[model samples]
Target: MRHRHQAAPQQAPWPHRVKRQHCRGLADEADVPPAISQDWRSFRAALVAGSRQARGGEQSESNQTLLHLQDPVLGREAVWAHSIPDAEQGGLLLATRQAPEVLMNDGLEQAVVFLASHGPEGSLGLLLNK
Candidate 1:
């Protein structure tokens, strides 16, 4: 006696794909530049001063802070400057800005440099190594 084989059931076609509707109200929010704008030199000076203040026992009201600097080469000059607790012994600590690409890759490109002490403070970095 020969046995008959049964065919497998087929799946129905997927429903017509519909594009998602996204809200545009939030997307229209314009980027407002900082009130005080300055050249690279002036910007760097401000950053250094702020770091010094924090180092000189000046406690920031808000533990978390976002410092914005306006300069021509923001992509290059802007960095998360930090001051070691000890000025003379610890010395100035400079962390090179890291970009998104650097963070995803190994040290193949420039490594995403960050301050070792940027703890509790919550830090985000950008790559400055062009």
Candidate 2:
């Protein structure tokens, strides 16, 4: 027995639509690679933990540093919050010894990246010490 399928009529004659639909159907949310998914989970957890720590009512420790200011009257010094901010535009990404050698293929190792844009969409950077 032979069965024949009929082609559906196109609302608009956009040839690329079929290809886009086919590609979208080939992968679903669960298709994300395990390593990337795990990394994302870890990053989210770190962010949540950092936020909770920042919101805690614990007073800053009395660590004296060059940036601290001393009050002669109260004999108290200001303690600045020691937190590394999240990545932002105009920030620099410095590669360290822990950088993988494979990054040398793109000259990213031992190099610095000047982030031009960083947002939910993605990040764009230019290599400074490449």
lDDT for each of the candidates? 0.43, 0.60
Cα lDDT tens digits for candidate 1, 1-130: 4346756666665322334346443322233234323254456557777778766744443423322233334534434444444323212333334533544644435343333323354533443443
Could you tell me every candidate's TM-score relative to the true structure? 0.17, 0.33
Candidate 1: misplaced stretches above 4 Å? 1-31, 34-48, 57-130
Instruction: Indicate the worst ten consecutive residues by lDDT in candidate 1.
Output: 87-96
- Candidate number of the best TM-score: 2
Q: What are the per-residue Cα lDDT tens digits for candidate 2 across 18-77?
A: 454556457554787876576764665466567868787434346343225554534354
Model 1 lDDT, full chain set: 0.43
Most accurate candidate by lDDT: 2
